[model samples]
Target: MTDRLPLFPLNLVLYPGLVLPLNVFEERYRRLVRDLLALPEGERRFGVVALRSGREVGELAGDPVDAVFPVGCVAEVATIRPHADGRFDVVATGATRFRLLAVDDSGPYLVGEVEAMAEPKGDDAEVMTLAVSRAFAEYQRKLTGAQGRGPVELPELPDDAVVLSYLVAAAMVLDLSDKQSLLVAEDGTVRLRAELSLLRRENALLEHIRALPAVELLRQGTAPN
Candidate 1:
């Protein structure tokens, strides 16, 4: 489906099925929250595109087209709390992937002409799903130990390959570009293969280093996935 969506360019990538919490402290984003709140419950959503080369809180020096990645996730508001100070505490869940066709910056916040992306389960999706899950389990174990925490407990994973892929993409402690690659993968099988490679690389690094930088340092100001 093709439609225009309010856009929120962030420093991080959001994957489908992941939960994102935001403190709407910026005036433009506070306005974005108010506008979404006015919509019907099911229709309250916006596009969350990762910034390519600009800060999330301010206007870019160049056009937004040069500042944001082409692919983004649709964030559907799940819960919202408005403060007396006109800020909002909003919890949104990633609903679908979209390709940004063009940008509109006349409004307070960015808006996009976006087309919903097709979600395909490629031929090897089932096999790759199992492989990625095993790799991720080991990766999580190593990551936990590296964090000085003992024994990672794997969460209950969904059987659907697409959901599983996005879940792993969200849960992994990786760089923005790495996660963005996963987000833009053409299908579940492709994403799972990429993730398998990433998980192995991370697991190896963790094994050799035996330590990791604090997650907060890596994730910066973003909410926990």
Candidate 2:
């Protein structure tokens, strides 16, 4: 099914079951949030598309549509606090992913028609799940060593594969484009497989760096005149 919803172009990607805290100071977005809050609690939802290349507050100028990525996730308002200065602080939970169809430019803020993506399916799902989890652990261990941090327990994550995929992707310290790729991937297994490959690549790079001798930048201070 398709529905018209408000568009919020942001610098972050929201995965299903993930919680995002936002500060709404921009006039247009403040209006959008206020309107959504006025609706029934169950209907306080909006689309959060990654900003491909543009500012969120200032004029998008020519074509606002070009600034937003096609794929986005729906954010359901969990709790909202309106400030006396007309700003807002909100914590929203990601619900579902959607693809933007057509933009409606008449509103103060950008609005678009979107279709929700269907549930994902894949082969050897269990195998892929284990691969993602183990690879992530290896990567985390390597990353911790590089950061000079002591060993710590890995975060406990959801057992549900679907939510697990998102949690892992969200927790990863990766390039924005790489994270976007995982978000756009079709299903949990596909995302997990892709993440596993990425994690392995990162592990390799970290290992190579660890093998290199550390450079001592601070030379014994010779008495300088």
The TM-score leader among the candidates is: 1
Report lDDT per candidate: 0.84, 0.77
Which stretches in model 1 have alpha-carbon errors above 4 Å?
A: 216-225
Candidate 2 per-residue lDDT, tens place, 121-166, comes to 4666788887788887787777777766678687765556677788
Global fold similarity of model 1 (TM-score): 0.92
Lowest summed lDDT window (length 10), candidate 1: 216-225
lDDT of 1 at 52: 80
TM of each candidate vs. truth: 0.92, 0.88
Q: What is candidate 2's CA lDDT for residue 199? A: 82
**What RMSD, rounded to one decimal, does every model reach?**
2.6, 8.9
lDDT of 2 at 176: 66
